[model samples]
Target: MDFFEVINNRKTTNGPFDPRPISKEHQRILMESASRAPSHFNSQPWRFILIEDAKKRAAIADLAGRSMEKLIADGLFFERYRPYFRFSEKELEERGDGIHFDQLPGPLKPFAKQIMSPTGVEIMRRMGVPKMLGRDNRDLVAGSPLIMGVMLDKAEYIPGKLSGFYSIFGMGAAMENIWLTTHALGMGIQFISTPMEIPENWQQMIALLGVPDNLELMAVYRLGYVKEAQRRPSIDWSSRHRKRLSQYVFRDSCDTPESDDL
Candidate 1:
């Protein structure tokens, strides 16, 4: 695939992926691509664990599901991310950022406006939405063929330090390389992120991965080959919209915004 095309087409796969295991060649390419990312003074602080074991994947999935349920049941998920939920086309166009809920199920349509409110959360709970969504999340992760854990060296990833910021920047670049490579290789990847939202769940993941003292687990991702026909989850949103250049970019001076037409 073309370089720019690969970038343009790259997206977080929200649905389940094909069950086939990733080919060895493609895995090697992903790791090598990540390694090629530039680091601060060549301090390669990033580490990765490629998990293909079914049992381990199941365990991770369980934690992920339970975390999702807890977050939703306690109304933390909606409360914390309320700003990023757009319920209308006009809202999405005006913001030009954040996920747009353009594919909600019929039952959720009437409550779209108040979905982030406490009352809306209570309604969802009464409807058993948390368990339903939790099951969907679990199935998605459990069916994935590969689970990758990203880590950083503790020496370089210290909090409130210059090296810490640099390490995170380098890790982002490395993950971007891997993410784009997955798109070019006919595979899909999404972050297993809910577990990180809960402290206990995050610690469990670290233990399950057997992370060493020297390394800190930064993120987890599930990956597999994509299917032609993707079945959307019970509830879904799309983040295809992006901020225009004029909205986010600046010229030489901060006061001058770049022209989007250019």
Candidate 2:
């Protein structure tokens, strides 16, 4: 398959992966592919620590499991829904006499109201927290065969004072390479950003990976082989209208319209 096709077909796999050990040749190919990833100023800021040790994988899985348990026990899992619905700042201010909602940012004022809204509370109740907690537990218990820690160097320079963006961008490229290589090798891969525990745990994981203090752990990826291919959620690409090239294109002069074909 073409490289572009591989990218288009790439999907997250969380189901069982094949237990066969990855061969040296296959590992070399995957590492080569990752090395080909683009980086700013030829500075490859992304470092991948492959975890093949079963004991270490189990320990990481345990941390993830405990984190999820803590979140459930503390009722922090419901906080994930806060971004879906919120109230307007004006409504928040109107509801109270001394509650200066205007003092808050226009975008955030509504979030406070959302937490207090009856509908939001109802949605939270209907989220079936127990079921989600159970699923989280299961996911952690079935640890992946190949676990990788992605770290980013803080010294990498990005365009426009966005050093973090450059690091993440490099890591993103490496991640795509890893995914495609895994697929071609008849393996499975899944990204688990949610498994990131508290700041202290994050620090510990980074330390275990032997990354520099200036660098931070960006993500954790799991790889394995499975008979079942995870199906991607169908996207409604046609539902939204796209802008024509002419809408944003310009010629030599600022006001001159450029030919769409050109």
Candidate 3:
């Protein structure tokens, strides 16, 4: 596919990916392409750990489950993740950021919107609905054919300085390279976020993965062959998508916003 088409067509797949393993050649091509991303002062900080072992993936899922339990016990899961769920039909129609109710599974779409309100959450909890059900990501993390643990090389970045900030910026660029490359390859990928909600859970992942102490794990992404996407009922994502170009692209000067092709 052309670069522009690949960029616009890439989608985050949250459902079960095809169980077939991606080829090693394709994996290397993607990683090598990501590594070629420009970095500040040529400081390449991005590192990756590919988990192909079924047992290890299962272990990560177990860790995610524990984290979900902790988040609910602390009453922080639904509360902290409100930004991800669109609460009402109006918000879903208007907002460009975050996941919409229509993006959720058909059965959960109604309840998924309820996470937007505290009263809604409390009512669900009182009704014996498991809080973990709302945040469960074990299947996404473990069931995929490949899991990538992204890290930053501490030695490549200067601590407590502009270099640290630059490293983060560089990491994003690198990840974008990988993300776009995945779409170009006929594969799918999505970030695994549940484990990072708690410090202890992430720490356990670091230890279990045997990641070097000098590296900081920033993200986990699942990869596999593309499967048929499940679209929600009565929702047209093509028409109600991201923000307009005017909301971002500024002209030569901040005040003279529309002077050029914004």
Candidate 4:
């Protein structure tokens, strides 16, 4: 694929992926691309564990589902991420960022605008939305053909230290490489992030992955081949819109916003 095309097309797959397992050659390419990412003084701090075992995937999925259910049941998910919910096309166009909840199920369409409000939380609870979402999340993770765990070397990832920041920066670059490679390879990937939202659940993930003391598990993601006919989830969001250049960039000085037209 063209480089720009791949970059533009790269996205978090919010729906189910094709049921086929990813090829070993493609997996090698993904890891090699990650290895090529630049690191601070070549202190390659990132580590990855590729998981394809059915039992392990099911275990991780259970953690993710339980976390999502708990987060929604307590209304913490909305409280924590309210700022990033865009309800309408106009709001999305104005912000040019954040996920747009444009693909809600039929019953949810009426209360869509209130999704960030306490009243909406109550309504969703009454409607069993939390449980529904949890099931969806569980099935998505369990169905994925591959799950990857990303870790950082503890010696280089100390918080409040220069090496810490550099390690994280390098890790992001490495993951971005992997993300782009997935797009180029006709595969889709999504962060299995709900498990990390709850502290106990995160700990469970670390234990389940058998993460060693020398490394800190940072994130988990599911990957698989993508089919054009794949179905969307019960509820979904689109993050295709991006901020205009002027919204994010500054010119030569901080006082001047970069013109989007330029």
Clashes of each: 0, 5, 0, 0
lDDT of each structure?
Answer: 0.91, 0.60, 0.73, 0.91
For 163-213, candidate 3 gives per-residue lDDT tens digits of 788888998999888888888988878776667888878888898789987
How does model 3 fare in lDDT?
A: 0.73
Summarize candidate 1's per-residue lDDT along 128-219 as a digit string, tens digits.
Answer: 88888788899999999999999999999998999999999999999999999999999999999999999999999999999999999999
Instruction: Provide TM-scores for the models.
Output: 0.97, 0.63, 0.84, 0.96
TM for candidate 1 is 0.97
In the range 1-262, model 4's lDDT, one tens digit per residue, is: 8999999999888898888999999999999999999999999999999999999999999999888888888889989988888878899899999877767667878888786688988988988989988998999999999999999999999989999999999999999999999999999999998989888889999999999999999999999998897576665554789999999999999899999999
- What C-alpha lDDT, on a 0 to 100 scale, does residue 106 get in candidate 2? 37
Q: Which pairs clash in the backbone of model 1?
A: none
Clash count, candidate 4: 0
Give the poorly placed runs of model 2, Cα more than 4 Å off. 81-142, 157-160, 229-262
Clashing pairs in 3: none
Candidate 2 local lDDT, 133-199, one digit each (tens): 4455436334566777777776773435666677678778887888888877777676654456466
RMSD of 1: 1.1
Please list the residue runs of candidate 1 whose C-alpha ends up more than 4 Å from where it truly belongs after superposition: 235-238
- The runs of at least 3 residues in candidate 4 whose Cα sits more than 4 Å from the true structure, single-residue gaps closed, are 234-238
Give the candidates in order of TM-score, highest first. Answer: 1, 4, 3, 2
Global Cα lDDT for candidate 4:
0.91
